[model samples]
Target: MELKQETQTYEMPHLLTYYECDETGHPSMSMLLSMISMASDEHSMALGMGIEKVQATGGTWVVSGYEGQLAEQQPVFGETIILGTRAVAYNRFFAVREFWITDKEHNIEYARIKAIFVFMNLKTRRMESIPAALIEPFRSPIVKRIPRLKRPQKLNENAPIVEKDYRVRYFDLDANHHVNNARYFDWLLDPLGRNFLKTHRLKKFNLQYLQEVRDGEKIDSKVNKLIENQKITCHQISSDNQIDAIAEIEWY
Candidate 1:
């Protein structure tokens, strides 16, 4: 495919709010993910591919995984931050996008993340080829070799694991009509408990979503209780004997 209009990057400003922050006064991981996701949505809308437009083709965009790094210093509530994203590349089966959170001046970057997305058939819930209308505007080079994100480490079952169960709630559903991917971070991190979450800062993470988590299903979120001296922890989300997602988090 020949390249066309290529305004690949899109950026917007967001005012941090109290509700998005945790006890430590920084935006929670899940909210951080959500904010970047909003940027991506805005990017698509700017290119005339809104959710309704995309869904009209009988499919929707879904994130398959994310890998990101965070700085020790984070923006606090009441501050204005910049959310930026760009379509990196795409292939017939997948698309890659990069995102960043920074101060308004772009001097202090709080986080840098990348996600792999796939087109899924809404009715059949199966993978599909990327629609040229949905992807061509970004002008990301269509390559046979799409980049792959780092695979998260598998949970060590032999190690001491902390497990918590949660019921999928109606509120968890987003515009895609499934549990929002960002909400999974809440379930994944809550098992770390309050004190630990307050004291530690997440430095890096990789999360892979293997299956869709639907509303009304009972799910288990588990994390290794024994953190490596390296300050790394492994997590898993599962339901009905199947693993739904897995992640590895590195903390400072």
Candidate 2:
């Protein structure tokens, strides 16, 4: 995991608003991802690799997956927190980034995240080698193998499951003109219902984005309960014609 010594980091002050918190009063998983994502974007812009710059190259950074941990004491509404991120490393087609959330005073860190990203040709919708100009700006070394994320296994045929459908709202769109990567969390967790959601808290999580969900698309979010493992649950979200994403979570 060797990377450049001069890893550049950027931080921004963020307030956890009521809408960002779930019924339990903790920042929702999706919202936490969104906050850190904003930090990552800002860091890129500061390094002259901003959204416009990347898009101008005829491609965009696409999140392949994210693996993160939720501390027992999660951030709550109305509290301001420090969101931080830095590019870690990159290979030919993959780049790694890290993110964190801490109290305003920079104490009591609540979450830590590692995500994998790839460059894609927008028109062709195919993977492309990450442009050197993009990676070099972050000062992260171009490594032989970027650290890999935990790959989620496919759901079992006999796994007990429940599902629900959701409509992509206008608000889910982000600067990329696609559904923000974090918005999928609501669909991923909603099938568990309000009762299960309120009683449990996410302790560990992983997600893989297989396809992008655009505005006006409808998704079928399915959850498979792992009877042998009380702490683990698997999810698969599909649009009318394709599987959009798959994820797994551990609750305690």
Candidate 3:
């Protein structure tokens, strides 16, 4: 059954857990992303394109990246919050989804997200056109060009940058057999170390996943301080000198 625009959104109750929060007692970026990704999956299942059905299509959904902001009033550990997502739009190879976390009353929103997803063929691991049967339920229109989020700025390779290395852990591998998209946040923020992360809060962030990092791969996460904007930091992850991803993060 196709979902009408009026009912295309899906919401599920979530209880913030101590494990999902950082020393600041706020949700970590990685875990928060996992919440919305889970909500997107739930929304898909409700529309009849659950994991099994999607797998049968011989392709899997891949998150290109996300652009979002955190509100000042964030939910604390143990708070029950609402995680919601709406299948916004799609073209042949890409889909756009919007997500949010809000209070039960929905009078307060903790965060808002926009993400781009593409279908990748299982064996070939190359992008493929989204199957009509798969996307028909979402009731989004197909267009020539999919919408692009505010992309993270590219890293200036010529500039001096601080760097740290991370080994893709077994636990970081999600069902897709790759380093989970959420785990990138861990690597991205960890380079700043505990002091900076605990002292400041993320106000806005934009990320772009140019390549995938698989299990057992060593990634060098680098940070370049913006000369013009001291408050802003630019980051990129490279494997064997090849960039896997780039991002821009701002804090308050």
lDDT digits (tens) for residues 84-153 of candidate 2: 8888888999999988888988778888889999999989989999888888878877789777889876
- Tell me how candidate 3 scores on lDDT: 0.85
TM-score of each: 0.96, 0.92, 0.94
What number of clashing residue pairs does each candidate have, in the order they appear?
Answer: 0, 0, 0
lDDT agreement with native, every candidate = 0.91, 0.85, 0.85
Off by over 4 Å in 3: 1-5, 225-229
Candidate 1 on 1-252: residue-level lDDT in tens? 111245578888999999999999999999999999999998888888999999999999999999999999999999999999989999999999999999999999999999999999999999999999999989888898987888999998987889999999999998677899999999999999997898899999999999999899999999988644549989999999799999999998
Question: Per-candidate RMSD vs. true structure?
Answer: 3.0, 3.1, 2.3
Instruction: Name the candidate, 1 or 2, with the larger TM-score value.
Output: 1
Q: State which candidate has the highest TM-score.
A: 1
Backbone clashes (count) for model 1:
0
Error of 2 at 7 (Å): 3.3
Pitting candidate 1 against candidate 2, the one with the higher lDDT is 1
